[model samples]
Target: MASKSAKKVNLLDHNSIKHILDESVTEVVKNQGYVEDVRLSNAKLLIGTSIIVVALIAQFYKKKFPENRDFLLACIALYVLFNGLLQLISYTKEKNAILFTYPPAGSFTSTGLVVSSKLPRFSDLYTLTIASADPKSISANEPVHFTKSITGWFTNDGVLVEGLFWKDVEGLIVQYTKEPKKSK
Candidate 1:
C-alpha cells in the first residue's frame, strides 16, 4: 500500500483531474451553437415581409395623406435611413458564415475558429455572411455549436445572423469569442 503522504498526493491529483474535466464540459456547452432549418427559413421570410410592409406604408402615406405629403415623405425617408443604419450596425456586430471546403463528420465547439469578416447586403432584403478563420475541411454529419452574443440589435435580424452562424457551425467552422463588445 502507498504511504500516507503518497495517498494525500493522489487525492490532490484526483481533485485536479475532476476540475479539468468539469471545465472542459462547461466550455463545450458554452461554445455550442445550434440553429434549426425552419428558423432560418422563417427569418428570411420575416425580413422579406418587413421590406414589403415598409414599401406599402410609404405608398399609403403618400396617397392618403397628400395634404401632409411633406410630413409623410419625411417619415418614410427617416424610416428607410434608420432601417439601413440599423442593418449596417447589425452586420458589423454579428458573425457571418464559415464557408467550408469540406464538411465535418463529428461535433465540435466554436472555440478554436476565428471570425474573418461579416458581410451585409441590401438588394431586396437584408442578408449577411460571416467568413471563418480556417479553411473548410470537415466530415459529414458533424455536430457543431456556434457561440454568439444574442443581446443586441433587433431580434429578427439578430436571430437571422445567429442562424447563419449556426449553419456555418454545421459546416465545421465555429467562430465565437468570449469577449464580445456590448453596444451602448
Candidate 2:
C-alpha cells in the first residue's frame, strides 16, 4: 500500500517542543506572582481599613471622655506604629521573597523532588505548603512532553500542584545551564 511507504515523523521538532514547554512554565510562574500579589494586597487593604475605622471611632468619642482621651490617643498611636512596622518589613525584606520557590533538582513531578527548602509564612504566622501530585505512569525523574495544566495554590503554609509535568519546568532550569546568546 502507498500509505505503508510513509513513516511516522515527530510532529514537533526538539526546539519547537522546548519553546512550547518554556512558555507554559513561564505562564505558571506569572500566575504564581499574580496570586501572591492578590494575597498581599488583600492583607494590606484589611490592615489599612481596620486602622482607619478604629482611628475614626477613637476621634469621634474623644470629646465624650475628656479624661480618657490619653488612652484613646495611645491606642491610635499604637495602631499607626503597627501599620508602619508592617509596611517597613514587607517592603524591605519580604518584597521579592514572596515568590514560588522553584525546585532545584528539576522536578518532573512532586514525587522524589524537593520543592522548597525554607517555608514562607503569612502575616498571620501560618506556614505554607506546596503540593503537586506525580503522574503514575511516569517513572521517577523521567521527562515528559510539556503541557501546562498544573494547578497550584497556597493554603496555610502549603502549595498544591496537580499533574505537575516537567516540560513546562525545563525553562526555569535552562537559564542556569546555558548562557544567553548575544546579538552581534
TM-score, each model? 0.28, 0.34
Q: Give me the runs in candidate 2 sitting further than 4 Å from their true place.
A: 1-28, 31-37, 62-65, 96-184
In model 1, the worst 10-residue window by lDDT is 1-10
- By TM-score, who's the top model here? 2
lDDT, candidates in the order shown: 0.37, 0.40
Off by over 4 Å in 1: 1-48, 61-66, 94-184
Best by lDDT: 2
- Candidate 1 shows a clash count of 11
Q: What is the lDDT of residue 130 in candidate 1?
A: 29
TM accuracy, model 2:
0.34
Q: Write the per-residue lDDT of candidate 1 for residues 31-91, one digit (tens) a residue.
A: 4532212333355456657766766677766456658777677767766765785576447
As for model 1, its CA RMSD to the true structure in angstroms is 20.4
